[model samples]
Target: MAVKGLNRPVIPFMAYLLAAILLAMTPAICLIPLVDSVEVWQGLEANTRDLRAQTESGILLSMGLVDTGLKLFDNTLNHEMEEAFGPVVAEYERAEGNPGAMDLSRVREELDGRMEIYIINESGVIEYTTYLPELGYDFREIPYFYDRITEIRLGGFFSADRVVAGIPTGEFRKYAYLPSPDHRYLLELGLAPSEFHESRMALKYGDAVRELVNLNPEILKIRIFDCLGTRIVGEECPDDDRRLSLVRQAYRERTTLEVENATARELTRYLFVDLSDNDYASDMSMVVELTYTTKAAEEKVAGMFARQGGVLLFGFALIGCLCAVAMHSLIRPVRNFVEDVDLIASGDLDHPVRVGGSEELVHLGESVSAMVGSLKETIQRVRASEEAIIRHSHTLEEQVRERTADLEESNRMTTLLLDIMRHDISNANNVANLYADLLATEIEEEAEAELLRRAKAGLAKSIEIARDVNTIQHIEGGLPSPGPVDLDRIIRAEIERSPGARITYTGRPVEVLADDLLSEVFTNLIGNAVKFGGPEVGITIRVEELGEEVVVSVEDDGPGIPDAVKPRLFERLSRGTYKESGTGLGLYICRMLITRYGGEIRVEDRPEGGTAIRFSLRRAGTGGEP
Candidate 1:
């Protein structure tokens, strides 16, 4: 049956789909039994059980042989120790009443083969020993001394593995101890692991304990523990808490224990065995634990799974090919429709979609072509509107340029007219002063000559006013290029040029960011000070450095500037005092020039007497313009 919206003739599509489904199911049917069948699971379990049994048997047999060998060595050593010291101990007990009569040193020499003797006196001091350095040592404080004495007092030698120090060399000796002579002294003797198999009686068993450890490759570790849970011999034992728990369980129960927890990586089995038989302590036991890792079992299981995994991989490959073929048939018609729709959306409407496999796709292609035809008509209208807008914007840009040019031309003419007026007025004032000087030479009356001189001075002042106005125009029009200027050099030059004023400059060499006009700032301030401060004006110029700028001050010792006048000292056409014949533009020009250089100028009353005119300028970079 055909699905909804798939309104095409679908008999062929349905047949292809049925063939693909059957092809995919064929491999799955064959491989399912190979993976999850009852026979396969049973085989894996059977192999694991067999391997575990073999590992257990080998480990148990080795441990049993080792236990038997160590027991034999313990009994032989105890018997030999008793035979050598049995009689001497009896004689020493009989001579206890006369302690001084027994020769302990001679007794030590006689029993000094394969053993060392210490003859501790009644006072618990080692009075004589085969090892001379131990002779004067006090034995009362040592635990082993008292433990051995207690054992011997009950009429038996104390025997165990212990560490003891030897003669003058003071080297360690691992050994067994034999206490005798009525607990007055004790003898220690031991055999190394290699020496245990040297005797003919021990050779029959043939180093079984050491040999068993070497034979097994699966055994990761084997350890032997004494009754006290102290390790006696074996490989270095594992420090895992679970392994320690197993060893402790065996020691306490005096029985065999086998533990295998889920989290444990190795199987551990602890077997407690008696190491003493006949004339040896019955409570003495040794714990032998064997540890075998899961390496062999894991390797077997990994190989089985690897083989089965190969079959499953082939099954998946066959399924993937069938699905690829079936999906291509279902998706090719839909994919072609989508591609055509994307092309039209991305602005390509000329190519029409021609997909014709099914009825639904044919109808979709016809709808796309109709929509593309409508989109083409709308784009033509948009293009025509954009062209008209671009033309209007170009016309506006030309009109703005023309208006800007007219404004620039008008500004130039105004500047030129001011320059001509200043020059002509200055020439007229200079000619009038020359005529006044000529008239002064001919006239005889004193009053007439004085009047003429006053008129001449007025004309000179007017000329000066014209020159100041021209300078102000130049400053307002545009500022000059600024560079480093030496402050100390400028101050000294201006002081020498001022003939009337006695100026004293005291400052270190400093540079400021200002152009050649910087000298004019100092010259005007000094000249104004000389004129305003009577004939004998005393001026002191000081230059001080601020963080990123320098301040220059001109202090005059004369009548100080008034509070009202100080505020307007740098204002245009303003004067400190109206008594002097001078243009008021000097301080104003100074303020303008300082400000143009991103600096400031102001006047304040001097602390000593007169006025201090200070101006600030940026400190210039060293060596040049920066």
Candidate 2:
């Protein structure tokens, strides 16, 4: 058994529509998470790259300062050698050919031991020196010895970092040679490291690196390593051992390497790049490693994800609301229509079904209501016919002499019922038609006026049907006798009775065989022409005598009936044209009345334009004239 009062279909329909809306929104909702993830990851990578660049720049800056210090030191050394060597060479030249004659002790004592002077012969022997450890030292088999000897021989000065036995001393030294007068011996001077901490340039370079490090907290360590893998400036980190392996890989691969510690939430990056200029080594490079905490970045990403999640949820709720509104608008009216159908099926024909929705659905409801009304009317007629049949059967069993009276009484009752039905229903229809006409006159909207016009046509049709029923009853009882009816006077009288029309007629005493109903036929035709025809319509009535019959025509400048519908114009409920509205009984009744009066009626096209309805009737003779 089905559940009562359950709107089973409505639930599923609404669900289906809502599901479709969700499906449409799914792609956008899914992309939100992916976008958030990409944004967070990109942000971290970008920060790491920027920090690595700053670290490399700091290391390069330190290398530049160290080079500047070396250049300044070399310049000072050149000046000292020129100052001391000029006097020493003067003494050695005085005692030509005597290498021992050059007293280096006096020279070293005069400079306060800041300089070292050495005397070497053409045989490549260090004959005299200020420091005793360098006495009898051989200058032969050294590139510096032969190169300096050649420079002296050429009479030009040369300076270099004086390296002994292929090992570089930490001290920087310069050499200038003075040959004896005979060019057999040379004097060389060198400068070595001393307490130069107060040098402004050197202190500036050192202080700058420290200041840079302090300014950016992200930089955990800044180291400057020379091309020979020796620390040049800056402190070496305690964690250098762990990070050194990756630093070597960065050098070997000639690229940067980054590593992150999950437990510490720290990120370390190693960059290996060449120094642009350095006095320590030619084509030199260094490794700069920077380590920073990732906690800040991670926290930022978390906050971003939280905000994005909130927005996504808000959008989801908004979409759900829109779906709900759509479902209500689309489904509520359909549900009401279904419930009304249920009520109608249960035999509640009199219950009003409030209708709304799309045009097609509204039209559907209206057709249903009309069907119910027709059914009710059919049922009432059936009941009345059954009662009449029973009464007739009972009258047949009455006394033979009173049978005629019983039959006449039955006929009278039937006639009276039809009259009451026609009178009451026709008056109601006329009142409705009058209201429809008034509404059509006042309404300015074309659509509203069209509806009113249709309503008026409907009411007019109902009235025509009632009149047709009366005519049918009269025909069944036998039509009344025809008498002399003046065609011209009847047309004039009908035209006068009908207002809101223009009728052109000339009175002519051409009498025809028609009853009092003769004027009704003319009234219907004239009214139809004025209603359907354009405003300012002109109607002409013409009557002619035909010896034994007379022909009367009513012509109007209205849209003519189509050939297709003309044959059925006189058939009950058959409208003659698409533009013709109402119960087609008007023309049908005219045809019936004409036939009853011993006359014939037909329609034709007018010669100029419009339509002509003509009918022939028997001419009224002197004997039966009215």
Clashes of each: 0, 0
In terms of lDDT, the poorest run of 10 residues in model 1 is 161-170
Give all TM-scores, in the order shown: 0.39, 0.35
How many collisions between residues are there in candidate 1?
0
- Give the per-residue Cα lDDT of candidate 1 at 109: 52
* Candidate with best lDDT: 2
Tell me the spans in candidate 1 whose CA falls farther than 4 Å from its real position.
1-73, 76-105, 108-306, 342-350, 355-626
- Give the number of the best model, judged by TM-score: 1
lDDT of all predictions, in order shown? 0.66, 0.68
Q: Model 1, 1-626: lDDT tens per residue? A: 11223445534445655776787677768677466644665786686556545544555565456545555555656565555455446546766724445555566456554455555554556665556656677655544445444454345455554222232334434344455545555544433334343442343212344455455555677676655565555656446466667777887787789876456667677877654443332234567776766666666667666777787777777777777876787678777777767877898777557464556566667766776788788889989988998999899889988888888888888777778889888888988988888988999999998899889879977876886788788777776577777778887887778877788887888888887677778878887887778779898888888778788888899888888777777888887655783788888888888987778888888778788888888888843345
Expressed as tens digits, the lDDT of each residue in 1-626 for candidate 2 is: 11222322324344556667675776587567759777777977697668656756875677566555655664565555667766676667665657566566776777677767877766667777775666676656555445556557445443333211111333334445556556666667655445242442344434556676676666666554443345555677677677667766776676778898899888777667654332221333566666767777778777777877787777778776876777787767678878887887897877666555455556666777788889898989999999999999777766664978888899899889988989999888988887777777789998988788778767776876887787767766786588777777888889888776888887677777887788878977897787678557889888888788888889998877788978888888787545556677788889988988877999999988888999988888844444
